[model samples]
Target: MAVMTMEQSTSRSILPAAFRTAGVDALAMIVAMVLAALAIYLFGNAAMQRVVTYAAIMLTAVLGLQIFSGNTGIVSFGHAAFVGLGAYATGILTMPAALQRTALRDLPQFLAGHEMSFFTALVVVLVLAMLVGLVTGIPLFRLSGSSASIATLALLIIVYTLLVAGREITRGSQPFYGVPREIGLWTAVGVAAMAIILARLFRETSFGLATRAAADDERGAAAVGVDHRVARLAAWVLGAVAAAAAGAMMAQFLGAFSPKDFYFDFGFTMLAMLIVGGMTSSLGAFAGVVVTVLVVEVVRRFEGGGVIFGLQMPVLFGLTQGVLAVAMILVIWRRPAGLFGDRELNLLRRPNAKMDPVKPATDVAPTRAAAGPISVDHLSRRYAGVVAVDDVTLSFEPDSITGIIGPNGAGKTTLLNMIAGDVMPSSGIVRIGAPVRQASAFRFARAGIARTFQNIRVFPRMTVLENVVVAARVVEPGLAAAEAAARRELARMGLERFADRPAASLAYGQRRRLEVARALALKPRFLLLDEPAAGMNAVETAELVSILAAVRSERRIGVILIEHDMRLVMNLCERIVVVDRGRVIADGAPAEVQNNPAVVAAYLGSRTARARQGNDVQ
Candidate 1:
């Protein structure tokens, strides 16, 4: 037997082997689902079992939707098309050749003559659905917000039309029967369990984290080097695969169906489940499915009422739908974040109040020699006819603290935006090492540039540690390495204790510090800060000054700050650039810029103008 070294033994015993591979939340969810399935299997009648089985299938589909819509905050109305495709593909492949010869005679010769097992048909359908998702996502992911949602709705319409119009392949909205009814309650329960695990695991991956970050704050995520389009596309493809699986099961369960079965009504029902339960987590998806299915079943039984309390009851048409709609509205009004609110159901105790401190990995540190001064030449930005930044040529050294300050509307923020690649220059060049020809924030971030917004843009839905991890992942190779880097930054910024707390729950001063920590986690060669101390109190401002001083001393990275806090500017910045009315008026050491005649005249004139305007006000 070989003896283990102390270091090896310590590492091995640090965390449970199972938790290293999976999260507590995922395991808890799986257990809950299994128990629920067992309850139905043991006690329910055949009819109740059937309803639960159908609910399991719906859960799979809803989980798929949650994977995309929940993470990207982009509601998709077209995912049902993938479900429909899966059902039709499975049916066509698994149906007997004899039946295909009669019912689907117009199917292609290959499809008409062949039949496959349920598992094989499902595999084929999943692959086909992924292909469709990729092709559609290329165009659809290019859009965001309401435009993207509308595009998805259009996708559903197009797919529905194709299913109805392709008379030879689909029989043109007619029922295509003879599908093998091989799927039972156990099969659906197994698939749903798998989907739940897959979704939960994906949510913990780097791609999923990036997608959720982008959903929370697009510009902020971009500033941390997240590729929003790529993240969204990955979620889109995965969600389609899940939806396809659900469709395969549904086809075998029902044995026969028409295009209309997966049309508007079907899509709306799936959407309702996601909305009512919560659109942000796998747990919410599960809860929503159970609640919706139970409500629907109960209401359905009373639709053709016989009697209640010895009184005759009239039949109520569409009562289930009406009640569902009202329930969704209530959930939206009372709990807009959904029932779970982006949280997982974890019954296990939190492993530890604080994460084990990990030393900073040397390989992930910033290479000082690789950084060069950022040069901006004749940079100008215009909006319509008004110039936001006009011919403001400047250079920022790689190891200096520079401040750009003036009265309100002095274009300080605009100038910083141009340099950080958040805004396009109308007619000028910004060079990190070479001229950057495009305005892309994520590209700049990946090239050793990181920034914080004037308004705090932390991903509010993410934990404090996760906010920094998002940026750290840009430079680190894997999630573990990224987390180590993040924790190091959090400790340095005095946020280690609040690592598990939501970013939105932090105090204003703490949020400001958190933003700085997030920016620092990128190991950027240049860091741009806009009004970092805007809402901070005097004590917080003093702490910020010390933190910035230490950062400059330790990292030797260039810092460009835009603020109206004169005391902070005078104390923290070695060099100052004064801008007024979109033009640079003075630049030198802080003392020199402070006393420059042009700087004094610009401030005095602006104050006078403001006073005159106030006097003229009604």
Candidate 2:
């Protein structure tokens, strides 16, 4: 019963409320990183300093993994290849003259003669890794779940094979030496800090928000106009860059390494750090790195028989590996969401903040005049031997509500899906102002066509307002404007009360209204609703009808509604289209379609000749 007004959702600033809040989280991270660096520099011994540097490098790599895997909820095992690429690229470009002359006799002519500074080497490798990420991510990221994981593992094997086979470049399994030991404690710390900031900032960006939305639900995000491939690719490239930079630093730190250095061992360790701390938060990644480094150091000391106080600790066989394995297991078993989950570190709250009542949108909203009427010309869809929608032709007028009604197994949903670009029409054209050149969900949405799924597809992890904001941003230029638009739309749907709540937390009816609000946020020319009133009760149905009427009247947008509720359709629609099996049977006013003989026969079965004539009809 509590509603979040516009004033409550935003403050007097150009930045959106969400971004403003993220600034505080960023500050917390900055403070923690600076303090940790200071502590290492002031009190640590030489061994401690080296350990800190190594930990920082690991943190950078883990943060990279966090960006792609954590945000997109897709695990990647190929970042190890990126690490190797960075290390090998740096080594090849900076090998000492003597070593290069002796070991790289058959190396590439340009590479054999070059020796670059550490900074220059780092940049080159970073760019190279990102390029690799872009090329591989296009096809690899297209797969999801285990398929994507397997593809990434295949990439690791491919890179390993290339490194092992390229004797001239990588020395063919022999250690590549003569790399400059340039990554000191302070340099590693500085790079790690910068990487952390970049990782955290990316997560707060609008693109990041959209990527997370798509991760939560693909169909839902596409309906809101999110392009999944583009978002995923962007993250993948950035992540590769981070991992590459870390690898370059590690190369300089170790001074010599083999292909095995950047293989399964390194990749799994980074993944474990990410998962144990929390994959979704930058703070979690940082914490995981710190915890794992300490654990490994302690175990390493025990492995070599360290003297503690007056006692001698005997050497232990495989203790470090066993401890790390057990820790990873316990972490996964107890907290799958990670220690911090998706929360950021924040220390203070402004208790004096007030929630002011907001005025509903009057004429402040911008107009979407270019979105004209939509026309479907002979749209047909066939699956194998069955025709889901056969030669369906319909034109939805501007500022009007058209309802599609049919019995079970009819083509209503299929036809709607085709128009929304979720399903491709076997043969026909869908013209929205102009003939759609391509039938894609995002393209259709960009062309001012928005839709809601038959089954609700709200981003379960995102807040109700965020769900609308993601869609609104497709049309609005700025995040601030999108937030404003989303708030207004929520208010219009009476969803303002649940604005701050998670979309998954809302009641079933509220989720339906949230979907409508999300669709409207696109400023669409045509709004397609597929059984929007599917599970609603009498009162909810009436309210939905009113809302649709308001949307059509206020926005001057055409609406195509697919509904099974006869009363709701009969009362709310101005024009009705009826379909039987896969073809349109009747189209006219509600009353005419309701009494059509074909409609009756489709829904209630055909009548006998005597019954039709009303002569002693049984």
Candidate 3:
């Protein structure tokens, strides 16, 4: 009976327990899918079978979209492009050879000669979709939020235009026909079930969780060594493949469809399903499909002027579309997260989570004590007329703590960002061992440099242990190994007791330590801490100083510490680098810098220094 603490329970009252358990959530999906199969088998006529089969097809496509859109928190409207490609691929291949000779005379030689089974066509569709995903993901992933969404919409338009203009192969917008209809109710049900299972499994994998962490906070994920580009691209390709499969299945099910079938109308409907159900989980996808299908069916009956039992109904034009629009709007207004809202129904017993007291590793590998010193050679960063870091030169040695202290806007953080590869330098180079060329944040992170932000940026949705495990995965390949390492780090930070608690439930000081713990999980050679002691009380600050001492003394890890606390910096650092107005003002030992006249004037002001010394005490 493992349960969250009082603090943890209080923070996520709206979240469901089942949503967090993969086994339970997956079982719920299996049950719903089985019930759908049972219903179709027991009482389905030709028309009823068509309705259920169409719903299953929609579910498959929606689940595919959920893999990327739900997990990455990026809304995409371009999945239909892949669907359209799949439809064309299947249509061209599965169409009769005689029809291909007569109608698709303008198609490529290879395509016109090939007419394959559904499985073979599906494989080809998947490969083509993956190729498109790889090409498009490179640039699209560089942008975020609304910009990324708009770019995907642009992709839809581009693909649609290409399909329309490519008249030779596709017969333009005139609708190419004569395809064999091989997809049946059982086939759709089986594929839909597979899609649901795949989506759920992917969402629970280490790679999937890593993408979600990035979606929550990109900078936080980067600082912890998550490769943002790679994770997003993997998801994009996977989603594209799934979408392609659904498209092939739909083409075979519908018997014939035009380019318009997979364009805006289909794309918007699929996206709306994901949004109205809850884009974060597969259960939401399933729930949305069921609700939309039911609503559409009822509205269609009214629009057709049908008789319900005995009485004849009045005809209602566009009623089906109007109802769907209103339902989507109402869902958005009332429950913006959708009806299920990332929750899944659970109906199974599960094993309890093991909370074994983790023993310290007997043979813990030591951090690189003699990793070559990080050298900053006249590094500069300028935006328009403003210079954030102006030709600052410094070198940090291995196995020592170097303190960077200065007033606000003195470029201390800017220097760290350049070294860590967050900001590209306008001029000069940052060499970290062997003169490495072209440094980026991911490159520096992989090269044994880890940093923490001034404002704490822990992934709020992840547990205390998960936050550390995500970073640990960079160095450790196995999930078991990573979780074990994360536990050790948490124990070292005295956070073992709160391992299962969400990061947001921790106190301010605990959150700060968690950030440090996450950084340590990277096995960094040089740690860059930006104002780590910012929001700490006296006791907490002293604890942080002690923890830093242990990190240097025990692990032999070098630290570049930035702090406004003069006492802590002066006492802890062996060498101090002081900067003022984007340039180094003084660089020396604590004793020398404390007494230097320029240092005193820049930090304390001449009058304030004199007043403190009783020389200007009116």
Candidate 4:
């Protein structure tokens, strides 16, 4: 009934989204900059810079884990190993020992004993980590949920073994000297900034959401065309590169190092730091590193000789680590997601709820074009030899409102998954218009198709605006594009008012609206909505119906609605498809499909009720 009130619809070529420029993000970044400046001003000398640089490197590593673990909802035990990869690679290329020895035998002898610059060494470390990531990532990326976590642990073991066994290359765990101590405050800060920016962009993208969704529910994400393998690989390779960067920074700071520096001790050290620092926000990584490092240093300085309960005690450092670790464990058990979780801080709320409406956009990527028609032909999907959908054929015609209704065990979801390319078919073609054999999840999305889940998958730690912006993740690959696109989508969904609120805080109806808005931002030729009206009050359902109708008519984009709300279905669907047990039972206009005895009996459980409704209406 309501036509977006005024002009909530966004401009086709919008600038950046309001969420990308959120007042909070600017304030937080500014705070970081200010704090960095303050630290430099107070110390401003080599002594202090050397000390802070190591702390910064550790924090950067923890931040990388936070991205791979905290926001994406997958725990990585091998991040430290990636750091080792960087350190060892750097040591081999730049250290005097490496220059003196013709190790790696296969590598050119000229390269050995040839002193490489810090910049070159840094580049080599990152590249080596990336290459290793590409190979190791394949197996980890193929796994789903908790299983993938176990695989990463295996990866850590493999990496550790390689480093320790390669005596010739790594000097048999001995100290590799002549590794330049060239790291400084400015270098650490620059790398940290880059790492944080990359992480922020990943978190704000669809790839980030898909990672979480897979962790939360793999099948659900795949149904929306989110390829788990590719998403995981992107996270792994990037996270590995980050780890290498952190390791290089650490090596530069220490100036002398060995393979043992990157073993379990280092891994545990980084893990504790990440856990205490809040593991979900980039800011948390910084906080955790500073706090943990200070705590450990202060305790070690005292040598366990502290007064507890007015009694002098020994082994204070031991007590300090134990207490710190326990505190972190408790925080996690009680508030599993950590202080900030995956959300960026907001600083411009002005202390009034009303002023919240004027908050800025906070997206890293956004789409620029509207979608066209989406077509799926002979699409099918299978799981472990069982065909969920077999050679199914359908199309969401451009600019039409279509509905698909089915029972619990029907193949409606399976078909949707194939179109989205979340699940590759045993054999079939799926394309918006062209004939194709198969496509990647990102590719499917890029080809102009977007969808929502049936169970309402929201990123719990993210704000409403963040959720939308992150969905626009795949649409815009960089910071500026994502920012513009997320803003335009937020306004369209009427969620501009609730932009900064955490997703878990929103009412059920609002969450549904945000999910739809995220899909719309993809600017798909067709939108597949799975149960948009599920579990809604009458008022809420009515609101949703209006919103959907307006979108279909105004956007000129076809929609495939998968819902159980009979009233909403009858009212909105121009044509309906009914299915049961992995196959379509009937297809026709709502009235005709409603009258079909088989459809009523199979899905609604009553033809008599349908007859009664028809009679009453007449």
Candidate 5:
């Protein structure tokens, strides 16, 4: 049994042992979900059920936020917009005929005349939320951090205003009552289940890995062929659907709703839960929901929505939100990572995981029967009028190791960036022979163009094994399966001994090796190592070479070695491409390239220096 060390920014996952079975955690999840459903079914009046349904709705909605904002380390304040759209869409489209006669009289012409079943309306609203995200994401796509946050707020305001001011369609800003409470307990549970499934699956997917990587360092992720925008957009749409589902469910629970329901207060509350629970884990979101909801329930039971603190007024109009606010502040001050950080919770109590041995990968020797060689045709990249790569063309044969070497400003990294599709070439095409079709950074890993960086970019807070597993996520099916595959990669890199150790805690050389392990997990056809030998001693560098050799032999994956350490490059590469100021100066075997005057000038400034370094190095 393989396992990652207990660490933040990662989880311990396992493959399905038999019949594609769920693990202890998954079974526990199933049991808990079933129990909650049963409790809602057996006990409780219509009102209690309504309360539970509301809680579930909030849980589902916040789960969406956690997926992108929490798990992926990006913040989005635009979630409420999604909820608002879903509610109005569902309300306007599915309002009961009897109530629609009076309530929707002033509604917009389009929705006023049209009505659909509650289920149909629900699905439609979810889709509508996605459409809204897609339509609006164009402007907000390139943003991150504070700028992205402000844009999200803008999105929220725009949607809120549209719902409120569009009187003809929304009954705008006015209270929308007489909405038949048709959302049943079972239905809400089903939706919550769906939300959990989606969140769980995505978090466990390769897309989720890329999302996290991109969040940690955009440039590094792009160099590895992960598209920054597309991954984020997918997260946005998924979040929108979940938010819409929550809103639609809320409308059914309330039996009526208004524009104010989709206000900043709601956003704040969800954000609070997201923060208090732990920003990047699904468990954190759900944990926050549990804590927040419990606080509210207790407060309402005692203070009746207000807390008794000496002579002052109640803590909250309703204790649920007010106490939750206090808790949020307290939690943020103390434990900012939230409940589990990036770790996932399983059924069994966790273990001392760092020392665990490795498990088996899906395939012993991952063969790329499809993709042939990767070719770069006259690739050029320019940034702000500066040519980063100029008319550089290179080819990486399948099952062969090649090296790209140059001085700091010679455009070695730029050329790799262009090949990976991180920086779209100014003029030229990157073609992959055989099964690989076209060149896209996002599809590179699956197409066999996985890579590592000079500056380590593994999931820092995650365990060493988790870092490896994260890389294979794109190639495998789910978290469990990916973990199984990653174990093999980690073992190959001689990192199984520290599988559970935090990547951040590893020495610099260890982190570098983990980076290589991660790239290997991708089952890539072509692997690029960008200064993998940097900051390593002779022993570490030799270890890296051994790992590289093993990778080529085991997986038959092509490799692009980018390094300043000429010794390592000469020792590992079959063909070497030397670039000087973004143009290839020499291309041939290591010894031949070393003898080139141009290569020598670029690396050592002249032939004499090369001879000196060669003697010293030998």
Candidate 6:
């Protein structure tokens, strides 16, 4: 027995770090829930046991929502539709043939004649829910923000309407009876436990991490090669499966339910539980369900006119909903992120050891073996008739460091943006290995181009290591390899010490370096940096120059920089392109550009003139 235990421990230690953490979190949650259920079963009456079962079913449903909405930061008001579908499907499939003939007389012959066991019926319901989610999500995921949320609300209304009108299938707003009450307290708890585990595991996967990165900052995620819509769609399908499972369990628990059971009121209650507890973690889903269930039980005792403090009270029709609404408002007001705010219950786990910084591989190669020079031909961009990049032509080789020095509004960043596929050119061609048309930033990133924004854009809520891991996972095959690559980049940028900390906690200079590290993880053929040194002190700027020079030499990849600091530009760049008023004024070696009359007039100005006069005086 000891030998078997040792083998199991050794095997578990080799799993990816993220999965291991998630496993521990899931175990902790399951233990807590089992203990609570045990107490209820041992001491509580039958009524309390039924309430616990109901709460367990609700927990499963809410966790399903967290899998999609929490990771993608998209509020979904339509998930309850899947829950309703699950109930109807389960009732139709599992009801006794005699009962089905009487209750759903017009149901399809195939469905009316079936009497499936609980587990078999659940499988069929889940598949139906997944198909439905896939069809609806194709178009809905295309829209984002408030628009996507409102679209979900519309979906709920549509599903509700269908259920009410489809008398043959759903009994038309009447109770769907005859589903066997096979799900007792233990069965419901078992399903909820599975949901909690699945939710935690999914959050540690590449899809969940990428979706979360997009939620933090879409532009940043794009630079790391994440397609937000695709990621969200995957989450939506899985969430639908979970909701359907919960709905099946609920149907058995009730033995009868109607479309109204899963409509507006139920939807609001599920969302309130999520919002009030926290939406970002599985622990929050658990906490929210527990709190909401307790509130409902207490409020129900007095809602129908009960003696309180030895006095008679009047009946209150909507007291439960009104109180829940106020509770949600108070929680949102006091803690906008909810009670636990992305934190998990990890009391049962041991503290993790500090990760040792790994040296970057010496033979790291660019993403493409023969990625040619990036060329821009007669590119121009206009904003309301005002030219931002005017008829610019430039070529950047894959084995050189070039600096683009220009005054503010001189269009250096605009040209960079066009090359990186963040902005469209008014009329021109951009060839990164080949001429491209209408490419998005993520596509450009996947095609051997990576860039840093003019304004620093890091995933603030993600760990410093996770920000790099998000980029690494784009190219690496698995989470373990991604984490290894991320550690290498963090070590290269001297950010390994802070790897476990949230990116938002980093200093301005550190965040700037963090962005560069994230870009490097993509292994791009061309690195475009915009104002990387803007907020850095002299020491940090000098360090950045050293790092950039080393990276360009070691990787043999093209580096195009836009900077206002003349000293750093002159020292680090092998070639300089000087621009003034959206036009290239001079393009040559640093010494030649420094002496050019046009360049001096446009940029160097009084500072260069004064320094020269002092040199002559000395």
What TM-score would every model get versus the actual structure? 0.94, 0.90, 0.87, 0.77, 0.79, 0.94
Q: Write the per-residue lDDT of candidate 3 for residues 383-425, one digit (tens) a residue.
A: 8998988888899987899999887888888888888888889
Q: Roughly what TM-score does model 1 have, to 2 decimal places? A: 0.94
Which is the winner by lDDT between candidate 1 and candidate 2? 1
Measured on C-alpha atoms, candidate 3 has an lDDT of: 0.82
| Steric overlap count per candidate | 0, 0, 0, 25, 19, 0
Name the candidate, 4 or 6, with the larger lDDT value: 6
Residue 338, model 4, lDDT: 59
The candidate that achieves the highest lDDT relative to the unseen native structure: 6
Off by over 4 Å in 5: 1-53, 107-124, 127-147, 182-190, 223-225, 297-326, 348-400, 406-408, 424-440, 443-446, 461-484, 497-502, 523-525, 553-558, 575-618
Whole-model lDDT per candidate: 0.86, 0.83, 0.82, 0.70, 0.74, 0.88
**lDDT (10s digit) by residue, model 4, range 384-407:** 867677666766677788888887
RMSD of each: 3.3, 5.1, 6.5, 6.7, 6.7, 5.3
State which candidate, 1 or 4, has the greater TM-score.
1
Tens digit of per-residue lDDT, candidate 5, span 1-618: 233233211433434321122134444554576687688679857667767777778888998897778645768888987887787777778777767878777654566645587888887887788887788776787887788888899989988888888876777778877666788777877888777767766764557767877777676665455676878888888888899889888876776778888888889888988888887876777778777877777667656433345554543455566777888888877887776666666433233554466554434555563477888878888888788888977777888899988877878887886676556678888886543234466666656677887668777766676566656666665666666677777777777778666677888888888888787777777888899989999998898888788767767778898887878888889999988878998999988987898776666574566688899999
Two-way TM-score contest, 4 vs 5, winner = 5
Candidate 6 per-residue lDDT, tens place, 100-159, comes to: 888887987766777999899998998898899899999998899889999999999999
Model 3 lDDT at residue 62: 93
Error of 2 at 308 (Å): 9.6
